[model samples]
Target: MRPPLAAVLGIDVGLLQSGMGGVAGAELACAVSNAGAAGCAGGYKLVGAPLSAMLDRLGTGTDRPVGINLIPEVVGAEELDHQLTQVLDETPPHVYVSLFGMPDDKVFDRVADAGRHLVVQVGTVEDGVRAAGLGAVVVAQGIEAGGHLLGTARRDELVAALRAELPDACIAASGGIGSPEEAARAVAAGADGVLLGTAFVVAHESRAHERFKALVTAAGESDTVITDVYEIGWPGRRHRVLATAVTADPDQPKKFIGKTVVEGKPYLVPRFSAAVPTEATTGRIEEMALYCGLSCSAIPAETSAADVVAGFAGVLPGSPAVTN
Candidate 1:
């Protein structure tokens, strides 16, 4: 049997409450960490003065291992690139990354100067090996994920493949890792740890809107769809969001999926095709669409982060089965 993943992350926070691009806020980041899960912060849309406010808020909360997911796709764009460069230059987190390979050498070097550990997300083993060689920890995210898939390769296959190469670097698995059992599976598959975005997005403490939470709660294993519509971040990258008018667009094939942002790193644009027809229906089902993973099936309704963490904690990789 594979050993239970020992906690060497130094994260006083649970390490399970990862933050999200759209949902992660100062309150959620600190609270989850205070609750014993590693607190994480997402800064995809944040730039300029907003960066200060975000960090200030995070400081108000617990001081656990905080992460700032810097998807190069957003900041690397021609329009926002400069501002992104400056904002990221000032970030104070212990961990940082150039999402979808954005920020490039300039940003990576800066993070190192600040004495921070950099984690790079990759979709291919080639990228993994290269990143490891560059001295950045690698996160092998699969395609079955919610927000963005940084890989151009197959997620499942890449997970096992990357393990063989970057043995010394810390490897965390993302993409469709929504449950404790799924986490255990990844550890069993040899991942040093797992980073779950969508799973925590639906938690009660999550800053995601109530409507967004409902969609995740009502969803089943087979309910979500992966598509390229409403994406302006990463060009060919796709994500699993609630099957709404956006993904349901019949014109998806004819028209390039509408990308909202320029960097187009992992997700392009993210406007849901469905929305409450009226303010009354804001929380209604038909109007709300959210990003989730294939692991959406295992989540319970409106649960607490601690309970959720406990549930997932039990799903640790079991001992390898004995052969006859």
Candidate 2:
């Protein structure tokens, strides 16, 4: 028989990567997957050529199962439909994840019929229950998570509530998970898997800017802030970013339209969109959304994705050793 949902989803060690936008690209995704952890590529802001290239790399680079996360609320209906069409038509990710909002009926049915795994991230116990009912794995994201703040409950509380409420549902924990001990604690608290963002954000294979990674490495536990400063296409969404000068922008625009270059091509998008960050992008790095969780202190100065998976392996039940 196929293993339970956790194993089948490559979350056997109870570890997963958070698929941060512009950060969790192919190199990082492949590295995490090769380490036997589920790595999700952020697909919410990507479309057309850029989206296609990312999926192509993920598909060709790794033998392990991978996933792609999408935020339905920010993509808008027309763009969402268009992106979904491109994904299904060109190169669909191994798993399709919908965050902030549930997938529409057509997308849900399409994923189901295609035998692809679907995951829904919820902020509340009620939403978790709804995701379970829809046959999608429920990612119970706590406010401590980096990038986007999802649910209101603490990670442990959310896992316990979900386990108690939905006995058969497979629940994953996100937020404030940065070390093996943290991952173990989440599993012990009733989570089948743990989703880590900040830990891998500093991974050697990650595409995060050097300064971004350095800030995370040098940060302490008290360095994070959840603010709506970067709100543009998706307003009122509080994301956990490093407490930086840019977050202090009192006159931050509610909605901004601008042209930013990615990979040497001009792309028009909302300002502060996570995809705006690239190796070539310059100026105002501090002003950009510096996504991070509360666990920056737990990250070592230098580590690879494989080592990250290994760090948590020893704590997981029946998991293999972290090998080089």
Candidate 3:
């Protein structure tokens, strides 16, 4: 049976996972909650007092349920978890969604101890089943998602299989979801909710670099390619982004990139890919990491987060239900 991911978060079957990257600051998370939606922060990498500060702002911003995306495999996880636990103990987020690697139930138990929920993002049916088996109430199946694909399953096929296997778990569909129709389709396809990242990245409230926003707006319907060619932060997983200089430009020299350790630290960052531009059409746009989904073409315009939510607020099943 599907786990009680939705009920734990205290929301309806229909929901939205705030798509905040490089911009999931406290303000936006609270803004999402204030706008009749949920705010999620994937801040496992955030460190020092700044992490506490960010969580403090999020707590003070709104009374809505908030979540953080945690990848257990990242170095210094223990410290990060400690900080997260401290913040959750004080501010008490609504949930904690984890990915990138498997998290033992011991972690889930810790989240539950905070009186919070636990949601896990998965890419395949096998992973989903394992998540449910491990006591994760929420299952986020990401397909064509912007930042991290979860790299597991085909969106439609996996959704159907997961539904049949974990009927009781709260299933949320993510990846390449940019329109009301897609959101509705997720629900009709057995997903209890929808998670959008790229669509929100261009929102008025989003802090995404102006140059990046412009590129997302300017990208043709068919733009977006997933490549791990020059990755630094998370190795092994190539991300999808607009054709940028860091990735595109055939004549550009292949700069060095790989996992490394500096000053007792472990992580790789080559000079060439590290200096990518953040602006949209600076022409250097093609040289930076601008994660986006293939569905970006359907985004009507660069608008406010509230307006984007409102656009799909009334959307419902249009086409007759098709058996999965």
Candidate 4:
């Protein structure tokens, strides 16, 4: 068996919440990290003064070590540079999970210079091995994962494959492992930890809309669809979302469907804007993107982030043979 993620991640628990864009903020991050799990801020497509301000707010809210996730390839060079500078300038997170692409030596060195762990999300064994060679931890993301998917393999298969390929590499499983039981199964299957996203989307501390939360709560495994329907800012990427009304309409224009003010500035909202809906989203509720995983079946109608973390800690893997 491998060492628990708590030892490797410097966090108290073996679970890590996904850095869900717009959904996870300081409030949710602080709550989860304080509960012993690693909390992460979604830093995708975010930059400039706004990014700095968000980090400042997160820093002020929690003294615990929190992480920030970035997809360098998805975000342009200018945006990536500005976002990195902003985070490094003020409060650099305790960990940096780079997804979609690998960061160059300079970026890796910068993260190490800030005394943070570099985590790379990989879908295949080749990528996992590559990331391990770069002295970075690997997150084995399966196809069942919500939002932006990484790999086409099943979660257990990916975790087992990654562990077999890199026995010494620290490996975590993300995707469909949602419940405490599933989390335990991943650990038993050779994963050092589990990264949960959909389960926590319904958490009280999450910044998602009430309607979105309700839809997730009522959704089942068959209710989700993975497509590039909402590819306004980030294109050619497949994201798993609920089969809402907008997804049914193929000819929906890529215009601002709604308008909301951010930091006292009004911004036009596009399809899948990565901007979480609020009371101000004056548009068709079911027409917007609703990202979720098949694991939504295990989420309760209402639960606290602390409670969710604690619940996972109490669960024990059923049996090695069963989990395997």
Each candidate's number of clashing pairs is 29, 1, 15, 0
Q: lDDT by residue for model 2 over 31-63, one digit each (tens)?
A: 887788788787867788888887788777777
Q: All predictions: root-mean-square deviation over Cα?
A: 6.4, 3.5, 5.5, 3.3
What are the lDDT figures for the candidates, one per model? 0.58, 0.73, 0.61, 0.75
Question: TM-scores for all candidates?
Answer: 0.77, 0.88, 0.82, 0.90
Number of the top lDDT candidate: 4
lDDT of 1 by residue, 63-94 (tens): 66555655666555553455445445655454
Question: Model 4 over residues 52-138: C-alpha lDDT tens digits?
Answer: 767887777777767777887687666677787777777845534545456665776776777777777777777788887777778
Clashes of 3: 15
Query: Where does candidate 4 clash, by residue pair?
Result: none
Q: How close is candidate 4 to the true structure, as a TM-score?
A: 0.90
- Which 10-residue span in candidate 4 carries the lowest summed lDDT? 315-324
Estimate candidate 4's alpha-carbon lDDT, on a 0 to 1 scale. Answer: 0.75
What shift in Å separates residue 182 of candidate 1 from its native position after superposition? 1.5
Clashes of 2: 1
Question: Which one wins on TM-score?
Answer: 4
